[model samples]
Target chain A: MQDIKEILWEICKAPGSPGQEGAARQAVKAVLEKVCPQAVLNDDPMGNLTAFLGDKHSQNQLLFDAHLDQIGMVVTGITEEGFLHLAPCGGVDRRVLPGSPVDVYGKERLTGIVCCQPPHLSDGKAEKVEPVEEMYVDLGLSRAQAEEMVRPGDAVLLHVEPRQMLGARVTAAGLDNRAGVAVLLRCAQLLGGKPLSCGVTFLFSSREEIGCEGARVAAYQVQPSQAVVVDVSFARQPGVPPQKSGSMGAGMMIGTAPSLDACVTSRLIALCKEHGWDYQMEVMGGRTGTNADVIGITRAGVPTGLISVPLRYMHTTAETIDCKDAEYTAQLLAAYVQEKGGALDG
Target chain B: MADLKLLEELCSLYGVSGNEGPVRQKLCDLLTPFADRIETDALGNLLVYKQGKQRPKTRLMISAHMDEVGLIVTHITDDGLLKFATVGGIDNRILCGKQVMVNGHYGVIGGKPVHLMKGEEREKAVAVDDLSIDIGAMNRAQAEQAVSLGDTVGFVSGFDRFGNKVRARALDDRAGCAIVAGLVQSELAYDMTFVFCVQEEIGLRGARVAAYQVQPQAAIVVECTTAADLSGVGAGKQVCRLGEGPVVPFMDRSTIYDREYYELAFRLARENGLLCQTKQRIAGGNDAGAIHVSRGGVRTVSVSVPCRYLHSPMGMIAQEDFDAAQTLTALLAEHIAGHPAV
Candidate 1:
């Protein structure tokens, strides 16, 4: 309802590669400032930004977190043919790299194509995807010219424009997480005038794609009584099994884990049902693989829950999500914040 | 008297698997001054106790295993070579042509020189049976003087501190022991029982008995975990990193952590500003496998120092991570003492 596609477009376009997330941080900060002026914003040593809302004297603190960083690449070397050798900032599936166009962020923005030898040139084993080290990006210039435009340590983001597909499905690069960031922003906007009984800290963490490092620091710093980590879960797609993945456009996914606090989970499920929101449940036998992992064991430990937005083709260009599902996730969170105060404290 | 020097000395001592007398003695000597009561279990586990200010409703158990994976002498040849078998899980690939000391004795693991192997054989890992200990002795009698059948030998290595990290053999559990040692030296509010467990390399045999003896209501297993944060591994698969902080296992293959206790730790960490990360992958089991099920099932949580190349010689760990775990454990102990919830 709030031009969610446009918000997703702006966020998905920002170049934020793991440890270098300043640009994305600024972009998200601008949106958050406009929505929640009374919110307390703080950045920890690890570059995780948290915006606190509601009354500070509230007995319960509910932490809502979504990472602001996206998976990209770092320039490692320049080939003699003007190709840029790049190292992955996060887990970049090598099979997706060869034909992908990327926006290289250096002194100035440069466009490059990630390229490798074609099947006809090498042994049939060339079909077997090689490591990122064996791949390079071509910028269509001589080595000297390419070197003048880009240097080592430049960031490279996948080049893809956000597109609104049929109905509410949206497609773009980095939608695996920027959708989550967009949800946090939307939730903060909705909570502006609502009288809340609990203190809510909305964390726009950095470097979650690399490791849950930013959330780790922020969790230890905020030390909230309860935490809910909103992240992207693998969605059911062409090759993916529905048993292991959630369906896209099927609302939000709630995680059940051996690590997840059972009380928090039960309360969240009840809240979702009470508010008549579409939600699915995911059972994680071991690790939830989100900021919940760290937030669950920060100082002593904090009871944490995970809410996932189903995503297709994660950690790749053209990551896709359902806008309706994103909106329902934010609505569920806003409703949960209003209802979670008594249950969490008691 | 020197904690760092003692750590180096303890690390350098050779006592692998079944033959851990030298390491046990070193720990006993170091723990003697700090512990109010000290006793060794039948399985060679060092149980050190420090009484609290009041009658403890909960006995806090802290454990670190002493046994490290090494080689055991299976047969001694008439011509001074010793055939051995692995005492624990060892990647035989890294075993060929490495320096080793036999149960505080001078010896070296000997294997065929690279020049002697030909063609496809060079590509294959050297078999354990193809390796032996060479003490530069001519006959069985000379070999008997320095080594014997069933003699245990480990990588004779000293702890080396570099930048912010430390590399050594047996830091996996030795670092845990040093943390327990540090705790014993501090003024604790709870009745603390630190178990320097043995035979853990052989499937947590000592911790089972030690847990039975202490029967703590809550336990914190401070040990080392595998740090696979390196090149070539996917970011999602890098398990943990060095210097990031202590790797706390929310759920591992062995135990599902208590949710309340887990939250208690996270809350305290956030309050104290400690650096910590949750274990992202279900990989290995630890003493928590037994500690969680001890007696009526004690509530257990594990805080591990992330170490690279576990179960091998030259395990690397971040020193700050070890310290963070120590601080968190100490803080946890104090918290439990201040608030009796159980």
Candidate 2:
């Protein structure tokens, strides 16, 4: 087994808030270069990155993918008091916005905390959730100083570093996607210089959380015949229903949605069983709520399958994912590719 | 002043979102005389790219939604009354007892006459689910023949003029459409693209795709915004007032405008000697929500005509507000033509 703790740490630590994804994209690109130096790499006008192993041939398995853009705020306005008001790039839990520490990326990185109403000044009402409108960040700079350095449209990220949890789990702000990115890199590392019939393309797409826009354009550009999307799913946690959540540390979940390509998905399940790998089933009544939804119907259509890592507290700063599950996912993707796409082409 | 004849044509159209084909054809014919380059995309956004007489510095996109908030057919009862759903955000209180156009068949949305209401139902606000459209059909068979399931339904209101005031349905944006149509005829100093976008009321879908396709450096969305300047309304609560020129919003629910762009709009208004009002309260959104974030972000702001009782069958706007919207859009384009900042 390879130790990828360092790689995952570097990916989760970089701030790639929505439109400002250069930092995270750069970090992921560096790792891809180191792991698969021979693989052909390319990026689209929208900044969607892809790494291709094997020849660019038809009837192959293409990765539907995950994005590097994380949920954070963009500086929308600066108040005369030197405080900044923000617009959320993707999704940020409104309950977590008040009083949270943030790093605003402007001309220079500015450390600040979201200002909140103190309870002592309240007038006898129970603590109620306030909308994002009432929230602002205090940078402790004068108006002139802030104007000299920062401008509107800058990004602000939650200041939470990845931490080790009990039982080999990890928690951070962007584990919803950075973990998926880590799995793809590890898969490439495992598949380095291997002889294979399957043409595997890893799409480290951008702007997934805001919408499936990044992959929508990528799928349209690539137009791959077959695809497998990697994303994050809800894990068993407090206040979560058992039917909706998967067990952490079990394995990655193979999505079972009516919209998903049944043959390709069943093929994945068959490989997991044959290899004695840990796996689970995630059933959706409609869409799987991933990039596969958009990728499935791009152009005429692309038959797509989905695989998701189980994580708790999605979209929160403290998103938790078991590192073992990520390693297991990487092994499964690499083995599934080596198995000649599990009889779908046959 | 707005040409009442042109305003009449715009306000009386049936251009609901996601189904703008008929409206697009008519609009194309009207713009063909002025448009240097006109093309429609897969998602129904009509891009009318007009080049400048001089060298262009920045690409400008000025847009207005061709779609209006309307109804979608959901179910049909045996009595031929259709159970319907709203296509965009619409208050249920304004829906009851209003006339509607469902796929060419005129009908009336049925609400329990207050005299027929029983007990608490009289005291409660009417919900949309409780309403049905009566198209004078005797049975499900006749209703199906004229209007099939999944057909779009829009409010049925005709344009009327009363002392420089106009009231009509879809004026929320058809008013914006007329303003751009006039701008297309005038000579331009800077190259600009005028987009008639779709599905904006459904959440800026057309603008999102169109902005990506064009990748403009800056954009201005001409729209009609709500005016809550009714009698007894508090100062901090009124969003804007009708007849107060054009309302330039600083921020709204879906977007926060670039400070420089909003200020630029105000500056153009000041230089042109046109009346421009700032929104008193932050509320509704427009295509700026999606346009500003498309393709590495764009500088976008909105110049809206103040509308009273917006998104309804009887929305009202002043002719002078329409004139102000036209002036603000022209001056902004003219100013950018000279300054031309990225």
Candidate 3:
């Protein structure tokens, strides 16, 4: 087995916060290229990198997608006390800002902590937990020192390292879709040296944390007969309700949503059962909350199926997943591309 | 001092709603020695059962939430500032200029200084959208190295006593947790279930599962209700007053306490020579709101220590009110155990 932890560390450690995905794109691109050297690689205008494998003219074309970007913030202004004011680029939560460690990305990398005036200085006048707009990042620098280092447009991200936890779980800040990307790479690696009847497009999408822009662009360009979108789903834990999510280390989540192609989804679930693989059902009454939603509707509508690894702490620094789940998702994807029939289930 | 120390530790521990591992562990360690049977539910509700002096068909559940309101990291900016959202209900006003800790690192919440705000901005409170948590990372990668999206952060406030009042973050429920702990030290007349629930700040999350599983005939929810008896606030709207006594609210948004249990508490308080008071206003709700409706319904009442600035990092409470609430809750549990109305 490939050292999945090492692969995830390289992918997640890249600073790929929404629009700022250069490092992540470059890093994941290297992995894709290494895994499928014979595959034709291309990048769309939306920064969706695709590796084309197998025979392109085959009537059946399968596109596999994993978004590369994660949630982050944008620096909007600077305070006289050397603190930087920020705005959220995504679904930012304010309750977790106090004393958080961050870096001001600009001309220089300066380490700092998120702080405000202490209680002694506020005279009991501070309002209840302020919204994100009222928070700031203290660089531990003088006003002059801060202005010299940090630019207003720079981005900040969770300062965390990935770790191998007990029970074969891996945790980090940006494991949401990185876990998906890892699965995609593993599938490509599996199919690299094989002759296949169907074409496979492995897409590492960007700007997914904000929206499914990359997947949309790739879906339109690839114009495939079928697609499988991989992402992260809430894992059952202490606070989350059991019925609402799947347990981490249990199995992969096969999504059933209005936006997903029901036929393709059922076929995937049937495949899992036939193979005796660990799988769970996720019925999203509305949005599937992944790139599949946009890809399912792209260019005359492609049949899209969704697969998500059960992830704990979805958008938090401690986002976690079971390595076995990632490997299982890869095996399914690899088998999916190789299978041929008039219909996916057939 | 010893009792106050426990309250301080509970409030200081970072047990944000949905992330109550620390508080749960502490309570589990504390309760293991005395509890006859203890188990943690899927949602992290710690259920500790103690067989009373006499066996009874009806079981009494005493619940106090272990989770507190905090923030979760949503975005880390390129300039290394953190953007966040409140995990529970928090007024935008109390967020400016506060110290906090994420994971274990410390930072501050900063916004525009009053000196810099112009025109309309100065007239109103700053919108949360404009705030940022500066953790002193030099760049996006540097920040990402320490913090991660969705990492839970807590206020840096610690439990402290000044004069006759105690101030701390999470006193709203930590005070209640302390009360439950105090009750555990006393003898029970009937079998009792002590449930410390989670995610109450977001909703009555953990208590729902606990109530259904225990299915107690009667439940007494120990909580810390809002005490807005500050100067300039109207008397009718004060809701509750610190230093008076524990507030026994007749009704709140989530529930109306069992009429029989409501009247029983006051009668027992009088007989026991305890000073008990009714909440001046029907306002905030607690786990009782959920417990009363769980599994075909459980009879429930809420007894809260009056807390000022309920959701902020620094909530204030009267030490006397804390003591009184502890005494009253313990008494109510013993009463429910002895006199089974179920």
Q: Whose DockQ is greatest here?
A: 3
**After best superposition, candidate 3 residue A4: deviation in angstroms?**
2.3
User: Model 3 lDDT vs. the true structure?
Assistant: 0.77
The deviation in Å at residue A266 for candidate 1 is: 92
Interface RMSD of each: 25.8, 24.0, 13.3
Model 3 agreement with the true structure over B93-167: per-residue lDDT tens digits = 556546668877766565432222345544344467777776645457868888899999888665556456676
Q: What RMSD does model 3 have?
A: 17.8
Candidate 3 chain A minimal-lDDT segment of 10 residues = A114-123
Query: lDDT of all predictions, in order shown?
Result: 0.75, 0.76, 0.77
Error of 3 at B125 (Å): 20
lDDT of 2: 0.76
Off by over 4 Å in 1: A1-346, B1-3
How would you encode candidate 1's per-residue C-alpha lDDT over B1-342 as one tens digit per residue?
114555667687765766677778988998798789999988888899987676566667888888888888888887566889998766564554344666454454543322234555444445677767654444578677777687787864445664455767787778777777888888777677888888877788889999999888878888888776543345666577777777777888788987777778878888888888877777777888899899998888888889766766566677778888888888877776556547
lDDT of 2 by residue, B97-195 (tens): 455677776665544322223555543435678767766554578678778888899876556664456766788788888888778878898778899
In candidate 2, the second chain superimposes onto the true chain B with a TM-score of 0.97
Predicted candidate 2 versus true structure: per-residue lDDT over A253-279, tens digit per residue: 989999999987888898889888889
Better of 1 and 3 by lDDT: 3
Ranking by TM-score: 3, 2, 1
What DockQ does each listed candidate score? 0.01, 0.01, 0.03
Residue A257 deviation, candidate 3, in Å? 1.8
